[model samples]
Target: MDKAPDEAKEVYSHHGVIVKKLEKYNERESACSSSTFISFVSSGTLSVLEHNNDRWLLWVPEERNLSVESDPTEWEVVNTEKPKPPSINDEKLESRKIWINVKDLKSLQLRRNTNKMFFDLKDGTTFDVVFQHGDAQQFISSFRSFVILERSRRSRQKFYVKGCVNRELSKSFAELDLFGEQGNLVARFMKDLHDRPFETTLTAFSKLTGVVASGLSNTLRPDDEMVSQPSLQGDEYEVIPSTLDHPAMSLPPRPTIKRGDPLSVEEWMRHVQEDGSVIKVDTLLMTIFRGGIDPVLRYDVWKYLLNYIPYNCSQTEAAELRKKKIQEYQTLCQQWRSITPEQEDRFSLFKDRKSLISKDVNRTDRTIDYFAGDDNPNLESLNNILMSYMMYNFDLGYVQGMSDLLSPILMLMDNEHDAFWCFVGFMEKVMGNFMLEQTSMKEQLLQLACLLQILDPVLANYLNSHESGNLFFCFRWLLVLFKREFTNDDIMVIWEVLWTDLPCRNFHLLLCIAILETEREEIMANENGLSDILAHVNSLSMNIDREAILSKAEAMYMQLLSNAEQLPIMACVTLGLPVPPDPETGDHEEHLKLSNMTPSDDDEDAFEKAMSHTFL
Candidate 1:
């Protein structure tokens, strides 16, 4: 009666699967449709079927003739047919059949609590499926049999197709013109391996072999070995290696500095006079640098640290400024809020930005109770602030990680006006990281590489020889200021400390150095290449010791100062220190502060030239 369903080889089938949510991408519109939650009691059957040499994950309503027996493992196929290609005109059929080619799957995220599995496709369509009868593990195991699925190191619930990842990597490497038109450096090197046998080539090969062996070992490792080992905790901190281990390097041993208690309410009050003018600003900054401001004082201290309130403003002046800022923020918000449907139709860029902001805000920090739950009002505040900011600085516009930076500020301030202005202040400090060209970000990475060379030449050499000299692994850390690496509580402390800008400018780079020093042994012992290094660094997320890293960075700062004269001029310039006269010529060279250079300015060219010559 149904034209006899096309016969196909069924690999696996699971019944009682329900489509909880569906979000489809409109190819003509170039935007995703709003997610629609399915409420009707429509149970479905999910099957992995092979047809025409391709595997597809097909889901069809159980109302169709296909049915599963009471055992759940046996299926009675009566009128089963391969789903036809999706069409824009047939809404009913589109909703009835959901087909995803296994090759197009970008990532899969599992929610164990709700038995939900989110499928993210390369075409930007998403499906949230819930298992009404059983967990998703059986389906996941069946799917894994067709593709090499590797669990993401950063997110435990996420799995990526190894083939897709490898293809992307291969494409990227192919695009790089490393050795110019002559030939690809890697290919040329390999071809002449026997002829040259250069030490650098040998070292590169050794690293590559180690990376492959390590990857194989990890993939084949037993389940017991996959269990995480206990990490050092409590009062024990990682030991810093002796500087004397490297020849011709002489520096003071790392100092032991105990972190002080957070600035208390009484201490903070002593710093603020009765008139509300902060007294002894330098002392206050140092106190915050040594130990972050207390959580209770963040609401007040953050205003000063973020420059929302002038240090010299009295109580009355502060109140007036607050009122004025509120008016300004409202005006900005109204600019975006007042846009009509007719206007949005013509303003594609505006619409696109709004769409992106909406999506990012929806998922920003839903795990946190403050922003969790459906229809949370706080999520609206986040969206409004970011939208207003788009109007405030239309040129910069919205970027992906901007939400990560805003979530904490919103959580702490808990008010639109204060949080908006505080976020503005924070953006001003790190805006370069979001530039179109990312020039400032590259400069920071290079500066970090140069600093590493001065601090630990061995590690620097290892990275450089292994094609990781760019230090791109730390991009996320610098981009969002370690927001992803640390817990919300830890980031609250880390961000405030960084905002103080005490000890030195670009002290965040020093924190990177501290982390590398802590992990130097493992990195070197394992001979990690670029990929391995990136994986290792990413796996460090949420496990770093806040106080230990801060103390080590501060101690390293002091060590650099102790040996400042002997340090390279590039190192001195990077740290914002005055460069000494040339040792041989007894002449002073102009110092360029790398932290202040931006791509929009002419100094960027000078910065690039300086970096090139320093490395040469």
Candidate 2:
């Protein structure tokens, strides 16, 4: 009981704990001539050394086991094995485990239990190990292992395993008393037990009592992101721009921030953390594209080009282009296959059959296709097209929509590099949308509005009158590069036309304007609300006949491009971000309100003083 607070001057101390073998339980013959080296058959019952020096280990061959409990979850019963003694050597110190750090996990096969006297101790009536604090004299100032005569007796103590009965062992590890300056470390440990894995070698201690090592793995960093379900998976991040025009148009002009107070890191972190499926998909696609492509494709080059586009293409024509690309991709795989099956052509293999971030994905061979009838070229060729293109652009590592783009391309050209070049060509204009910086998305949306207004000002007025101006709901469509808007097959057609740069860069924006035009009159006739109008536009995603949409979209592209100077200059350049304004709102008032809160502390203090009455 005197060993309560681990850091009190009277109780804090450190002791190296280990299980020492008292006597041999099941004896067997030795194999290796070394005095400490021992080997036994599959079944081996061995005694555990209850006490050992500061650092300890066991030795065994890779095939042999250090035999913990047979059933890991129920570690209470140690099934007796026919133990054999190994030729013991005083020591020939060589171990792979100690070289690599595994300070916390209880069960591992590091292959050192051969000569060492360490074995499973399933006698699980649990308790802790406490040591008393003492000065160097080992007497005047005391803190050391002090056990009352009643607990362990003169020799041994018998134990039985059962359900938890919180029998307090006053002399337990958690209840330690200590004294002095290192109190903070002890306090931190007690406050956050999970952090123990990072600091202590308590893994072996828990294993000695058959306790599960569940609480031993945790990070102590204060600002780490907390997840509902922790993953064993590691973390990686890569950002690339988006390519491909969407039905939605760009945003209008943005208001300035006006040299005011900027948001703090915490504010920014908080703002971006409330993510959506778009974000989730963003992370997934980027991860796959990163690995699925050549590893060298990482961070190649960044370009912000706006390639001009033309108009007048049909959806039927787009579909034909997709079929062509898929055929081209298949032919590329055939060429690579002819080189060798040595798997050396790093440029053209599926890094793995599984999707990135999938829990079931094996850590082993990621490139082999498991689902396509053992090993099919379809998935392989698809990976080829992806990796090839990822290598080609390098600027856009691969956005989520790129996969959608690639899949349809694979169906069309099928030859890796050729399909890749087409995707790269298509992205030259639309890629800005995928930039982390929202340039393309907002600009397209704004331009879409201008196009719509130019064509049918009545609907544009209806939208303006109802406060439904910016049309932000089309965000997903633009961000995903229209991947979500069209059916799997139809996306191929739309993308092919987009790739041709025909109907020019603003064609996609015109597509949206066309959609709004068809639905605009209906929207203007009803004064119920703008929600329905927005919903109506978004609903046109897959339902809009591709041929009609493309036809109208092309016509609108011509109408705007032909009247080039009249087109709205790209919106949002004023604010320096790609986000649009609420069609009817302005940020000037908000900026002014924020301005009042930015007085310096010194000025604030002086102002307070001046406000106080002199008489007071």
Candidate 3:
């Protein structure tokens, strides 16, 4: 184990630490690589000290005088960019060192099959921290806590500035040089050190000071009567004045919109049309995953999502493809319906599948306006699409919950051909869920159970006592993608986000975990049996919060990454991550854990912070 600095500044520290830097990559690319490394000081004792409540400062000693001791409080910043001085010169002076703010960190990522930890920075720098597994875990936990405290401090600071700005504004501004054209100089300094977005930092400043654009004055007339006059447009535009607006102050920079908010219809369409003909797939997916598509845009967005329209095709090409698909669908349907009564009867399985399809179509989402009523044409069309789907894929045929999946697609794409093709694209992603043997569904349940076991051992054991260990209760959610658990609008939101396939694969499973975690306290407190748990889960139909599910699901994804090494093979496969090879057999090992825990809100906050650091 690597020892702490001999002359410690802060009395105590986590030992056996190794640190290395990451090679740069495009922001959109993976963070799995750590090729570049930072060398440690060869002669002096390395130190990790509490820089403050929110940061950890690392110091590397330079000169060697055994009898002399250095003060912990005295430290110098090491600029790694500078060239090494002459070897004859004091080597200790050139020793590498840097200060790390806990909140400014991106992630503490572990390289698979290695005992190395990567400390990622918000400015796209990654450093490998070499430590024993146990020590690394402890250090990471403490670091994570400091990060949380820093975030909480930031939130409080936003309000704290608001609380006593009157007394401090003038004095603090002058002392901080927050005057004239430029705004708060202190904010700029803090922003550079923290490496957070300027908009985010500025928003906090604005909230504290109650100023919009700098403390500059507005030119608009004060009288409310002239506020709406049309002639005052352009250069003569009216500006709303406020208390902080002074003639001596210059205007503040225009505020940018929150990056993580859902894409509006205008933004969605403009992004899609940006490349003119070919759509930017990564850009589109990133936008969707950040928040989700607006409801109004789904009608057009669903085509790209379902792959009914090729992402790289031009507007003219898409139109041509759609026209061609329509003909093919009609032709396929015409042949199926043209079969003589005797010919159709000869195919015994067709009749059985058709009977099952009719039953499911009628039983599914009858309360929704789109599918409601005894003799509705929409319902009739839905039946036709399902039957048509069966004809298109005779081998798979009509399954029980297939209608549930098809209903929403049909509802959104009212055109018969488009609806059928969109459902086909959706089915491609979910085909395993509909298999008669349910091989995929069984695997998913096993994965979910394993995740619960690792994340919440207590919950897993409790579930075992109640005979719900197999997680059969989540079958419906996996099968139809939780179509039954939310309103039409909410379901669309969920589906669109899922279609993005961002962050990770099998996000729906994480969503199921999120929903389960939400109800954990209820189940645990009630001492609920498997039957009670099942009933409670079923009762959650149409009552789930779409935003809450997305948020929690994202948190679970981060938590999964946090403990990636200990994860089972199935869990790794479910999350689309690489599985480590076993030492004994020279093959990847597969195992399962039998525990579960309900994630707290802090997980989401940490996940958001990590994401901002890594991607922003």
**Superposed model 1: Cα runs more than 4 Å off:** 1-248, 583-616
| Residues 442-553, model 2: lDDT tens digits | 3455445444444665665556456454444454555545665677555644553443334244456665666667676677765835456545655565676666666666
- Strongest candidate by lDDT: 1
Candidate 2 vs. true structure, TM-score: 0.33
Give per-residue CA lDDT, model 3, range 149-186, as digits (tens).
11222221111110111122223323423111223443
Candidate 2 scores a C-alpha RMSD against the true structure in Å of 25.1
TM-score of each: 0.59, 0.33, 0.53
lDDT of 3 at 564: 68
lDDT of 1: 0.66
Better of 2 and 3 by lDDT: 3
Off by over 4 Å in 3: 1-259, 273-276, 581-616
- Candidate 3 lDDT score relative to the true structure: 0.55
Better of 1 and 3 by TM-score: 1
What is candidate 1's TM-score against the reference?
0.59
